[model samples]
Target: MNGNESAPRDAAPRVVVGVDGSPSSGAALRWAVQQAGLIGGAVDAVSAWEPPVAYGWNAPVVDTSLDEENARRLFTDELREVLGEECPVQVHPRLVLGNPAAVLLDAAVGAELLVVGSRGRGGFARALLGSVSQQCALHATCPVVIVRAE
Candidate 1:
């Protein structure tokens, strides 16, 4: 198969999709699932969360585990809502603490395709493309698919 193709039929492909618990991200997850099914591949649903930045020299410590738990829940709930039980394609949920683009790029290693929403739940929803999506498109090792909310 060509390098540009999403996956080859002989091998089990992995499609990594970014999830942010947003409508557009939901659409991207659904699209990734469909693509995985078509290619006989698996879906990796990923979400990234980070603690709020502190400016003082002696900054107050925040409970980052809560953010991690929320990220995990977001990934799982999004997958369940999109595919429900007995999904045709296998879905793997992953939550990490880092920038969205960096997390997605790391997840895309050896992945056949990387999928993400054009814009996430961020303030710039009206923008054509979110920073994460744009960065992944430019730097991902594999082909990237930006799913737009309809």
Candidate 2:
């Protein structure tokens, strides 16, 4: 370690947070951003969506673009609600069409951490952890942090 020598540059820890436009997710997003600032890392805000399909003996065809567009809007709104126009640390917004848990798990690969809320828009109202959060906690490659809604 001399004046002319330089230390190796290490990548900062990256955190992946699930955002579903829910109050709990809003809190999670805020928490993730704060954690990222503390760790000198970045935040990946992921939002997942599924096409709408009417349930019946025979379902009618629905326009998937509408669903995707809405997903994108919701993702943007959620990020804005928490991070405002500018985020303190780097924030990567990811909008994917698939199962929420699966999408989150995939995005968390090689990431330093995965963060999710204890509850979201769906699932039983009394469950300690929502399905997506539970799945991510159990299956995410990196350590999972469940942030409860305030």
Candidate 3:
């Protein structure tokens, strides 16, 4: 190794995973970590939230701070539960505000891969793919992996 030629600082790849505090999302988080381990990459766990549309113009004003805090806590708890104490890969939690699919897609703009889970609606065709997962699969800049609950 020549002194003039420095090692690539950004050689390690990045994988983004969407977590929505659902069982399937937990599985997806695990899957993303496993894949990151294999590829020598890091994982970014992203969760999104937005103001409820049902709040009418004349309706009582609601504070979104509480909701954001709860979303952050949920995201942290899910990450901790999924990764446990001996996690091998580096995982970063990202909380954003907006549509889930759009947020995930934006987060994964330059990622090596993006992972998400099916919402797992039972006894129906919608069980196959959730809207977010479907949109990500169709529009993500990088490869998208969809994990389904066993």
Score every model by TM-score.
0.85, 0.87, 0.84
Which candidate number maximizes lDDT? 2
Ranking by lDDT: 2, 1, 3
Error of 3 at 7 (Å): 17
Candidate 3, residues 27-76, lDDT tens digits: the string is 99999999999999988888888755556778856678888888888788
Better model by TM-score: candidate 2 vs candidate 3: 2
Model 1, 1-150: lDDT tens digits are 222233445658999999998888989998999999999889888888887755667876677877777767767777788778988888877777888899899888888899999888885646788888999999999999999887
Model 3 superposed RMSD (Cα): 6.5
lDDT of all predictions: 0.84, 0.85, 0.82
Q: Kindly state the number of residue pairs that clash in model 1.
A: 0
Per-model C-alpha RMSD: 5.0, 7.4, 6.5
Judging by lDDT, tell me the better candidate of 1 and 3.
1
Candidate 2 weakest lDDT stretch, 10 residues = 1-10
